[model samples]
Target: MSASATTRFGMLHGTALGEGSVSVHQYLGVPFAEPPRRFADPIDWSAPFEGGVRLAMRPGSVCVQPTVTAGDGFQGSEDCLFLNVWAPAPSTVPLPVLFFVHGGDFLSGSGGEYNSSRLAARHRVVVVTTNYRLGALGWARLSEGRANWGLKDQRSALRWVRSNIAAFGGDPRRLCIFGESAGASSVALHLLSPASRGLFGAALMESGSPIATPAGAAEELAADFFRHSGCGEAQRRGGQAVLSCLRAAPIARLWRAASAATAPPPGGGFLDQRTFASVVDGVEVPARPFELVASGALARVALLGGTNTDEGSGFVLPAVKRPLSAAAYTDYISKLTLRLEVPRANLSDVLAVYPPRPAADNANSRGNRAYLYRFDQRARDDTSEPVDWGVTHGSEVPFVFERGSWIDSGNTSFTPAERLLSVAIGGMWAAFASRAQPLPPAAWPAYRNGSEAQLVLSIREDATAPPPFRVEVPPRARECDFWERLQALVRDKEQRVAAS
Candidate 1:
């Protein structure tokens, strides 16, 4: 074969990554900088690839994470700092770009699972998936452990998109960032992180946020995680020895270690409120994003946020702990309401109004303009093992991409309605990326403080608000009042003592 023949067959991006392909164009894996032996490296702003060359096919490697133990579909690797882009074979209308940040509680999950076929095929858009450090590699903060390297990886990916995506027939200015779970939470963090301010225009947070975890608790979790790996011998102070051991050892061992975290199962977790999470490393995070949001220190970007009907039910099974009964829910409201510091009367009325789903509830229900939806559709996996997980954490993802195929010979059959809903959801997302607003009919309403108004979308064509749509926000959740009363009581006691 002549040199011309090689040129015609293979796809090449820039000179940085030689040449590669995966069922399509010149696929290139451009290394922006040398990855550190430890967790993350400084941002690599070097321009390794010349813009405009056709990118070779194949999605980027997923940032390394612990491997899956059981037959469950989880797997990972360390050489995962790659990013992949898919566009219409040969079009140049400056297509809208979609960047995905995979979710695994900032601990696991890769960008590999999400298929780009539907978005690339149906809407004529470019879809990019990237890998970021996960678990300890991404966010663990030992006395000397790297902090927010995963988030820095995200920033590097965005810089890559801004600089080169336009050459691949994508609009650099028109970008939509999407993620589920930790990815979603990362999106929230990005919104608040000044370093990530201009990386994306619109945002879609599936079921997580950066504000959920406090920094002090997260560092404690990292310290415990390292201790669990039996790394007390190293004088480095950081858990680097443990990190190095896990990185060098078989992937399974790391997964086992991560799974065996001293943190208990179910509610008590490695990334729970009381556990380690992406830390507020002064250099990278600066401050908790949730605090910024509460203080209105957020980017003025159009946002869309919502959760599944059983948001927390999948991770937390009631079978282990007794199901949350009505009385338990009442107790929950009384306690949480007190924490939020809402008036006792408001707590009673809000609890009376919103349907109690034990765990499934919206996070940002009031004081913002967010498009909200509840996915109630259930699916049955083709295999004998039923997939009746009701609106679980990841239930809506496959639908959005129609993973395998639609022809159901057995249990795996996506009805037309399901397909429509998926397309609508994806399309709505695409529309939001293209325009700041949502698709019509399903047009979402801007949120108002203490209001019950929100757009409730389902697979059904007609979009309507489910009765008592506003989720129940506990009073204590809002806790200043409690503090004020305690201070007042202290002052009164002091005054009486002075009188005596």
Candidate 2:
């Protein structure tokens, strides 16, 4: 039969085909680019789910998010840029659309992991997820030097949305781009990118903020990553060598090497610091994301961003490493000293305001109606397993997708409370897509800029309440000012050096 005849049933992204679901349709490995490179145009690529395009059944190529460290021994290739889309066939209404970008510190993640069938089936909306080049392959800075391939890949997908989402019954105009961890960071980055300006109508971020990467720091991190990637030695041979070796390296070899050095907790992923992320590329990326948001660079798109209830609780386990201690935690926090400033006196006040409750334990009260949420479904992990992770980094995916059957893939069951929480989250996400605002059993308040003024969303409590952020807001814009003066000083010093 042609591609249109198999409408009796369809499976979810991560599971076997089911019966209860309505008409299910999938479009795998659709190439958004001509040749998947900045200079090279994508070749004759897969057609959008057009007339009887073979439903290979599931997702397409995994995005080429590569990373490697000399101490570890990983290297990535150019074939990493690609995206996947899923939806219900023959749509009745022009469903609201959601575009998801996975998270991995702007270095890794693909759309394959986020199944939108249940979410689409229940909510009646079209959903899409993508895989972009990770690490140096995507985020590398050319000054070291290299162009930013990662951000470029995302732009390619946005352009694809502009051209083709209508075929899938999705309203391209009513677009919402959302993501978790680094994916959320991407949304923040896109907000600041020239190429990404008018692509989507709204955004939702989970467990990430615009504050994570500053201009100078982001560039230095790329340098350090390059040094770790053996790119420094590769550069000694010439920039071409760096690209040559990386291009030739297989994805598995690269990921394995990177993971060996900085693998994530338990069974999930590693935390290697190789592969650069979005830097203050003179053109694509300007200053910090907040600078753009504050300067009104973002398209005033409706935005929803939040963190999981226990944002960092996942890394607590280590079948391969030592458990983090209070001292280690303190040391870790110290290293991120530049992240947030807390006074000694205010420490007590802040703790009192946030307390050590659960996920998103203490969220800011107001800011933009960023729709902050805390995914606090009672934590679960395999106590018997070598890598027992709790309600962790990627633990909430199944729930949000409404894939209840697969939630506890490794015998990890969530409570009724968790399920209820998950359903609520799924509903809110769907509602947000259906309309710019959240679906309400509860009213999601707007975030006002200033002190404890952010809307904190949670599972148990009113999703729209204000807890307090440990860091102070009305945050001294002094950092931006400091950067300004520093730049001026550097310019003057450069003139002196040049004259000499």
Candidate 3:
């Protein structure tokens, strides 16, 4: 294989990573769409490069977002719809493709943060990571007429992959879309989106489900934005005036306003005031995602879904300024429900379902092959004050990517046993992408909707041994049932309010 590859766009000179038998052709910062207009859907890149040859070595700018550290302001640019690709070198046959979407609660992450060279070389697959709009630029329904531009950007990237991945030695038909956290939720939204059908053969979501903002909630978010960004008067003037005011505002000011509006209230949980999720716009998103799944309107593709053992600790614990007493826990729940708009009359029922800690196999019932797993392997936190994150949200990502660590700094070196676990998990994921099965049928069976046949990935108690590949029914089945009922109730209340 040469150092350059030609696609419809033009010739791209990439870097060769690794040496000897293990090597990958890595292309960075490849544009898949044109520079986007503020709050508008993405347009696919059709124009060829000016010079015909381009250097695909450096990473592109991140989409405009707030800095990870608070009070640091913003970084990145609006011209940020770039993607990175990694393919095994010296491949004779076209390989499977794994397209990954990153997760940052729809606010602060980039595709560049994940390096896929190892995953591509070891798994013998083509891996691609991409950027999408975030925050006010990506999600906020600044006007009553527009929503889900970020999701549209993702679909545009997928379309680019379908058209050009074959030139990179990837089988276009054998592509899998996977993501973690908000990315996982994005995958769920794509499954329910009509435009995303037939773009990917399989889908995997880690620690997220199909849920969209109701129309009323989206209006509230817009109002918050209007108030914070000083666009309230413009909004009263009309939609066009408000959009012009917002687009002309300083980028930093817009980010600060978005951060302020989206911040949870005092003693609020992660889900409180979550204004960055995909909105239920009648066009792109069509309807509420969970309702679509329940109605069996989801795409007929191979699906895998799971959550970590302690998914909420990372989001909730970091905000805890005091020890949690029973009264404090109840107060936390109250605030959460209030933000979710659950009526006060039903607070007791909500409390009954959620007691400190608790715990969907919707795919199989619709004739789609589906699997579920729980990542119980805990990561070692070598920070000065190492809180027990307990297999927190996103803990499984490094294992899936076979990387030493995903964070900027920490004692993230994997132990011998963890290295082995990483290999196994990565292999399973690649196998699923290659063919709609993660493992041999005898080893891991397809999940049934109402069964206890979930595959649990965890290391032994001592953490010095290989992962015990255990399959069991997830605990707290009754609690899950109660929560499902509560969600339905909440939806009903929202609907009644909307009607009124």
Best by TM-score: 3
TM-score of each: 0.70, 0.70, 0.89
Which stretches of candidate 1 lie above 4 Å from their native place? 1-33, 42-55, 58-60, 69-75, 143-145, 228-276, 318-369, 380-388, 404-412, 450-452, 460-500
| Candidate of highest lDDT | 3
lDDT of 3: 0.79
Selected candidate, larger TM-score, 2 vs 3: 3
Predicted candidate 3 versus true structure: per-residue lDDT over 132-189, tens digit per residue:
9988789887544488888888999999999999888999899999998889889989
Ranking by lDDT: 3, 1, 2
lDDT of 2 by residue, 112-136 (tens): 6666766677667778877777654
Provide the clash count, candidate 2.
29
- Which residue ranges in model 3 land beyond 4 Å of their true spot? 70-72, 143-145, 264-274, 321-326, 335-360, 381-385, 408-412, 461-466, 488-500
Per-residue CA lDDT of model 1 for 1-500, tens digit only, reads 00100122132442112112312122334443346455556455353335423354455556655455744233555666776665554564787888888876676666655656555666667777777877666666654335777887887888878777765667878898888777877887787777788888877777665543446766566655655565534424543565565456555554445555634657542222233357777656665553455455566666776566555445533223434566545544455444454434443223222221111122333233355455555443423323334555666676665553323232326566665666666677777777756655334455444443444445553533222223333333234234335546766786799999
